[model samples]
Target: MVTIALDPTPYHSTHSLLEFPDVAARAGYDALQLTPHPDFGPFFRYPKADDALVRNLKKRAADAGVRIPAILPVQRLAWPDETRRRAAVRNFRRIIELAVQLEVPVINTEFSGRPDELQEDSEAAFYTTMEELLPIIEREGIRVNIDPHPDDFVEDGLDAWRVIRALNSDSIGFVYVASHTFHYGDRATSLIPELGARLGAVYAADTFDHNRSHGLRYITNPPGNAVRVHQHLRIGDGDVDWGELFGTLAASGYFERDDALVVSNVFGEDETADETSRFQLDRIRQLVDEARSAD
Candidate 1:
């Protein structure tokens, strides 16, 4: 079955790391994707989780009837700078250890490279870092899904997938985030099919097509400044074609996969997160059902 998980970022401020499973359960989720958190894996830094903390977190999730299918740790793995790239590799090894300890199979992350400066170098650095970490990942039997985040060196979805494919490791896959549809070249129909089983997970959120209205959805200062603008709006609040996206997933047999994961990561409306999360769960289920029926 497609595991619907909550990102739980909205509750980070109010809830402790150990309390996340209960929050996810209260929000109508049976699983939660652990993102970069200070208590566990902070962004671009060494992880803070000890063996005791990991054990307690696992127990908490079990008690709350929640499973953590994935963990997202944003590291500068593709940084053009050697020092940062080395640090990222070091941090990622520990992250893989944490994943092994927690029994989580997937680690979703970004390319984390500087595209604006020395794009080629960033790509090269990414490959170098992967050379160092892929062995550990494969040995541990963990899957790493890369998201071509906006502003990353490989923002285009296909280009990112090519980078992952060139690595030639099934341990690496792609994360299709709905909020980043435009940045991904708005090619879900083709991209999802192209990735096929390599599509590790899908992040559920809505975003406006910045390319619309002559790229005026958001205005930046200094006119031609380098910026990537997007949002993590609730479903139906943005321009993402829910019908087309879900339809493509269904037709591609994603719904039949046992490892399929869809995460609700609406970070815009924390004030109403509980209600929004519940709504997302119901709406996502509806979309999945509708897509399957149509398929």
Candidate 2:
């Protein structure tokens, strides 16, 4: 099983995402979640970024003493429009470039329902990205893990499976987010293994609210809404069924002798954003020790 870490992007620039490695180390997490261009801004597709930015990211990850396992861009790349789709591909490539520098393990992007290309052609786009990036990812020795978020075109395991199977490449796979899976109305326990070899990693969190708006608020700002619906929450606090979650992943072949990758976070009416994450990590450390024994 793979060890889990937290996605610190919710805290944004104020916190150096790489700085969380100490917290993860303290919490006993193994990796960190990163994104390309953070991909959601109107400026996500900047053609003018220098390679220094990428180099800085690599240096930052090294300084943190943790590795970047996945790149979860905030943008929705699964689109049906040709132009926007091409732009998305370019954006994808740029992030992958940085992942190579950081020696990151996966390039994690989400598939929103709105397509910039033909829906039928999404497979083509998926392949297009793979075809273009695989050589570089392989050169960098990184894998690309695309997550199926509720806001995207492929919002669940079935769609994620279809898209991943279409690519038929080892460099690409799925990053499972539990709250997102539950939002798709299917429990993750049932989804992880059906993915088979295409399963790359799992993105786990706890939450109460269940709206995309609430999720986005969490993404833009920590502890997003007064009514938080699951972008990031500490395990066991909200509505998650942890027992079922662990059982499913174990049965899914993700955990055998018991290695797990969980990026835990909780947003609330908190003061310091970093403290919010530290608190969440502290909580998860206690919960995981309670839930599973570390051999």
Candidate 3:
């Protein structure tokens, strides 16, 4: 079974951590993929989420009758500088501790790469940081998932998969974001089925083809510069091949059993929070249900 969870980025700007659970509940979400948002006080930098703060958040979720199945902490662990690298490792340790306290089963994040450092060096830095955190991660028994975020060093999902494969840990997995299909390259259609059980989660949203002239529909003033441009739009609002995505997911055996997580990360413009949340959650549930039935 697939559980449709909400990524509360849409309300990050306006809602507090204490208040977002109620918002998610009103939107009919039973679980949340808690992303680090500025309004979340100490949780914005999860390492700063002290014991008391973690307990408070746990209580808040319990009060709202929602479960926090996962937590996403934004940390740049690929920095080449020794001080920054060490700090990043330390922060990750604290984050794992917070995850233990919150009882969050999965922890996910991007493989942040240093801007000026060579790719090889950044990759090595990431590995080193993870090596440092491995002790804590192993001790706590928390699962880790990673995404190839557009601005990160490994922006391509296939490349991210390569890195994850290199790590070769059973507890580590990939998160395929639909909006990132283009950057991940042409093989996503094939890659989806190949991932099978290794694909631990899906961040479902739609995106325009950012390669063709339609990609030029929106532009930044300083032309030709590298800019991260993409929206986590509602399913049908953009060009995502929903049928193919869902079908491939179904064929991959994702919905054959329980504990599969499909999160609605839709956020672009001014959308009524409740409506957007309900629409995404319902659409995903319906698609997963139909796919399972077809199988």
Tell me the deviation in Å of residue 142 in model 2.
2.4
TM-score of each: 0.99, 0.74, 0.92
Error of model 1, residue 153, in angstroms: 0.6
Error of 2 at 16 (Å): 5.0
lDDT of 3 by residue, 117-168 (tens): 6888889898998788766776788888888888777777677888888876
Ordered by lDDT, highest first, the candidates read 1, 3, 2
Give the number of the best model, judged by lDDT: 1
Model 2, CA-based lDDT: 0.58
lDDT (tens digit, per residue) of candidate 2 on 131-205:
665687777767767776654555657767777777766777777776665665665655665776567776556
Better of 2 and 3 by lDDT: 3
Clash pairs of candidate 3?
A: 1-257
User: Residue 128 deviation, candidate 1, in Å?
Assistant: 0.3
What does the lDDT read for residue 279 in candidate 2?
Answer: 67
State the lDDT of candidate 1 residue by residue for 1-295, as single tens digits: 9999999999899989999999999888999999999999999999999999999999999999999999999999999889989999999999999999999999999999997878999999999999899999999999999999999998999999999999998999999999999999999999999998899999999999999989888898988889999999999999999999999999999999999999999999999999999999999999999999999
